[model samples]
Target: MRHFNHLLQRLRKIVAVALLSATTAALAGIAPAHADWLKAESERFIVYSDGNEGKLREFVQELEGFDRLLRLRMGLTVEEAPPRKLPIYLVGSRRGLLQVSPDLAENIAGFYMATDEDIFGIALRDQTVNTLKHEYAHHFMMQNFAYPYPGWFVEGFAEYYATVEIEKSRILVGKYNQNRAYWLQAASWMPMTELLSKRPLQTARNRDSYYPLAWLLTHWFVGDPDRQKLLSAYLRDVGEGGDPVEAMQRATGLSPTELSRTLRRYMRGPMPYQIMTLSFPQPPVTVTRLPRSANDLLLLNQRLKVGVPDDRRPATAEEVRRAAARHPDDPLALLALGHAELHFGDAAAAEAPLQRLLAMEPDHVEALQYLVRARMEAARDAESPEEAERLENEARALLHRAYRADDANYATLLLIAENRAGGAGSPNDNDVTVLEQAFTLAPQLGSARINLAQVLMFKDRNAEAIALLEPLVNDPHRPSSGAREMLLRAKGMSEAEADAEEAEILRQGEAEDEADGEEPPTGN
Candidate 1:
């Protein structure tokens, strides 16, 4: 069990957009002298930090600058933000970060999680900002382009932009990755064939070489204008299942050994950086210091709300409960306690604090949503039909109230749709509209996309559902989020391509339908 949990944490490091940090001398902490937390809001991010206000403001400007740089690179003309704002917790130290993700590796300085419910990033502020920037680069990639990129290219692309310098005059990109310089010097070079053909390797030597080599390869492409065009074509082919090594050789007109030789020589001299002199628009940043009512509970709330290992959650829940008890009037404390209860089961226990929070702040979107979930889950498990109906009715009432409070709240809209999706009847047009709105609000949330697809297929809108499932199945970071199974069910792809277990589940459903003397629905 311990080994399995360790493996799970390692898996989380990769999938959670976790940032691995090298050793560094301890710099002065970002925390302010006072025991207070600052919440900074900008166009793209909502950052919480127990740090100097000036430093945190500068930090946010750098973040905004990076966002703009990425947009400029992609030629995104509109300055409109992505669907949802990413909440980032700039934990003041490495130890502070560990409180957010206890089982995560010690060297992992930062991480972000995009769960079905929400998205957030957490990082230690002691090191340079490269770690968070690299992880955010991955998030940016996930948001914009989600083709089945080869693992090497995915990491490489992030690495290329990882070492950023937001200067007064200009922004510098394509800078060298000084973090892995030691690994690059010490580790044996991976042959071009091995480098180009494989996804990502975990062997000690391969691990040492992977990031540096990938960054070098990516830099080589970025530096040469003509090669950039060829690289695009090569990636397209690889996305369509072409052999990476073969495609690379075809694109560059060089054999594996020759290409390797050229890359080595290309790095012999000091590498060039692409400096963009574009004006970075400074978005308005609002920083609010938390009142003592909430300030004392911020870290504990963040630790619980961000995430924790399953084994530690029970203990965490106990702590939250105690905190809530102490600060009975504090909304943050109550919200955290309620979240822990709902997340760890005992939906009944979740209702008290959530209800308490709602009574204090009646229009609180999160509290309303939590209360609705508790009621809905209780309805599901209600032994008596009368109790079930009563619970569901109350849930619907709360959803209506929640909608009135904030129609733009995606979680509220999603909950509204889900509240009706599990009935004996099929989804109505209204439910479909709600789901679509939720999807538009947070296409980054896998659940929103999946829920909409499920409803689309049910409505025999197979084409639309397939359109959604294809990119989902092709997503390099999270390919196995039931998208392929969904595609198979919609007949988006062939039965031969579908997983055997998925096929069996469908066959079982058909068999059950036949036994029940009903015609099984057909897929397109």
Candidate 2:
């Protein structure tokens, strides 16, 4: 098995290299170009495009169609208002899309990426409609379905929806995908048993073979009523924790050899398309043409700098401030400026922009949450006790509003837990519960782990604290001296000795913040 895995990995690498070579050859004459981006807002989508108005309209129409078809076919009820809107970026050229994400550009038409906050898409202008439908299908499945779906089913479903046809008043679905058919015709098919049992990594390793084959199999299953029943039963069994290969065999009552022979015959014959036309009332859409500067700010705001050091953060903040100044009334510009100020540790400076944003969008959850932090910082810096109390009260009120707007916000939950832990005395039972909830929501967040560990130590749950702190202390990306000190205390150091060491660390932190003209830490 180890040897087989090694061979598979090597084969994947070779295939990847060949694909990249092909893509590079195809894109030889394509030069990267920048364009002014425009924004369009529908009920469920916020599309950023550098394309013409007609192309943008087509994109909106196709997305609405995809949205309707996915919900209808998947037996999902339509919601009056979706909880979250997906953002789509339509770059004018393939080169422009590459500029947005160079690492993923090779041989990719488009992609959908989900962050902690939202799911979004980036696609080339020429392929905007098709790519949006394809990526949105994936996003819809992920967001709607809780159970783990097979990779073949997931990609097949996405490919099935990718080929959409928009008519005058309706949209056509399940159109024949020529690309997949071409690949299917060219490649030798994998045996049904092997394909059904393939893990995600294995399938990904042979995607050129896997994707087209999966699409073909899915097309065959859904096109024929008897096969569709078998597929449904197989999926049901798998969802109920049955072994997928066994489930397939039981559902279809076919041997592996028989299945392989049937699949080959199915692929060789003229394929029947299971096309459906769907019509639904789409919500009103609002389109706006943003300036080039605003587009740049939008990209900057969305860009993730996870392990990378960002020395230009201060300069970026300055540029965002200038943009905010020029477009003072624009809520997005103000929101960007507020985030920039917060990133740069100027919570006081963050207040005005955030407040301005709130005035424009009163129920903005993020703005409300940031305002809480900003107010807390101001409270810490308040010279008078009365002023401090007032600011704290205001911060607490804003936090309540933020919670009302979106209680599932992990950051807001963390802040509430931290405030509860830091106030008056040690963390209480409720504080521990909230911290645990935040940790559960986003276990990857080191700060949440560290904060929870601190509370665990206060509660004399040394074992729990140590368990939480060990991984964080060893993590190279997250250097937490506080966690290290807390770990020592959790391991049975004297409280006075631990306090002295922690105080020194806090003093150093304070000095660094002071040198950087940053506010003192307010236990956030």
Candidate 3:
């Protein structure tokens, strides 16, 4: 019996070791066969290649930076995983526009957009960075915020920021949205009350008019009237403690719903007179190429990937220090060193390399964001709340800089607007107003539509949700299967009925799967 107990103990010890090994491997990202890329060096960004990997890596980096900045700004440092790897493909020849996804289209020079799991796809080199920035904003907001924001503010802000000034050209970071002109051509202004209460679908169908109106309206808040006063009042009402709708009523002499109607009526044109003129000098040169290369720097990266377990990975801070020394100018290598130090839970070590990356690229959003987080994380580790708060302020300031860089990034705007809705601490008309704006910007985005539908449904508007879902079910080309399924499930079908239908489909699918030797998906 003593011998038997000894054997059992030995088995348990072996199992524990194996489990620990597995966990470590997983955390180190060793399981993904394609995660490793050939490292290279370039001026704009440290190039990593799995063939066109630079674009995706830069995208991820910028996104990471944006998030870190926001967290630093907001004083909320939630742990997050590295963003899923997004693959970018370069077109040797323009075969029309590459169909990046079901919903997005892009030319070789412009960019294409699509998402799978956490992996986002960008087709163009130039647009990849901006698109990543925009999408990451969406991902961060959805993950962190408690509630959804309004449509106008969401899309308007996205549009404002999505405009990228590259060389002499304005690259639209969001959609081209040619329709903004139509809204500009629409009649005079609407009351705030009516505008806030408008439905998303209704707004989308008139997006040409809606987009511009939203831009103008947002411009009004951000640029027009007594800019500071209007913003202070509006933000206070929505972000602090005032009612958004009531604030509008007080400020503009119209209720939120009434403002919606007035905007519609005012949608025709000119807004009586030019409220503001946004003018700027163009860049002297067109940004020719967003380059990607790093042969010498990547040698370490390749070794890290394929070398034996003990032989691979920098074993000490000194090794990381040495490797980073060899590739002094490579941001990725520096970031890797920083990431390694951060992994050891040393904020100071992490901050050093991250700050190095920032010095090279001031607008490096990902580094800025993560550096902020690391700084705060380090401060927190050092048990200094005041330092963390200062770091938070710096981070938020960085986001504002990114935000100010381009105001058209609807996704970022949506994040802020949504925050305002929930952060205001009360249910009022502002939430509805903001959501309506978001609906216009991303009409095809199911999440925003769902937000609208849910609000209506909560107000006992099941018919409205059904109404919204009905057109989408037959879309045949819905971007998300999940969204479609939700629509079907929301159609008031009994479980037994759905089960019966599913069983028939499953039986058919099984026969098909058997013939093909493939299994069907279990929809969760």
- What are the TM-scores, per candidate, against the unseen true structure? 0.77, 0.63, 0.34
lDDT by residue for model 3 over 1-524, one digit each (tens)? 99999999999999999999999988866432222334333222233334455454444344444444445433575234322222333322333122222222343243423211112223344434544444444444433442324445544554544433232222222233344645454433322332332122332222334446665565455434475376456644543324445566666665444444454455443332221122223112111222122322333322222222433233533455666776665676776567556543354677777878878877665455455455444544555668756755665575565456544333433443433433444234566555555554444445566666665555566655654543333231232345445555566666577456534433533343334332332332
The 10 consecutive residues of candidate 2 with the worst lDDT sum are 198-207
Q: Under the 3 Å rule for N, CA and C atoms, how many clashes does model 2 have?
A: 0
lDDT by candidate, in order shown: 0.73, 0.67, 0.45
What tens-digit string does per-residue lDDT give for candidate 1 at 203-245?
2123456667878888999767887898899888876667677
What lDDT is reached at residue 168 by model 3? Answer: 22
Q: After superposition, how far is residue 149 of candidate 3 from its true place, in Å?
A: 0.8
| Decreasing lDDT order of the candidates | 1, 2, 3
In candidate 1, clashing pairs total: 0
Residue 112 lDDT in candidate 2:
66
Residue pairs with backbone overlap in model 1: none
The lowest-lDDT stretch of 10 consecutive residues in candidate 3 is 282-291
Top candidate, metric TM-score: 1
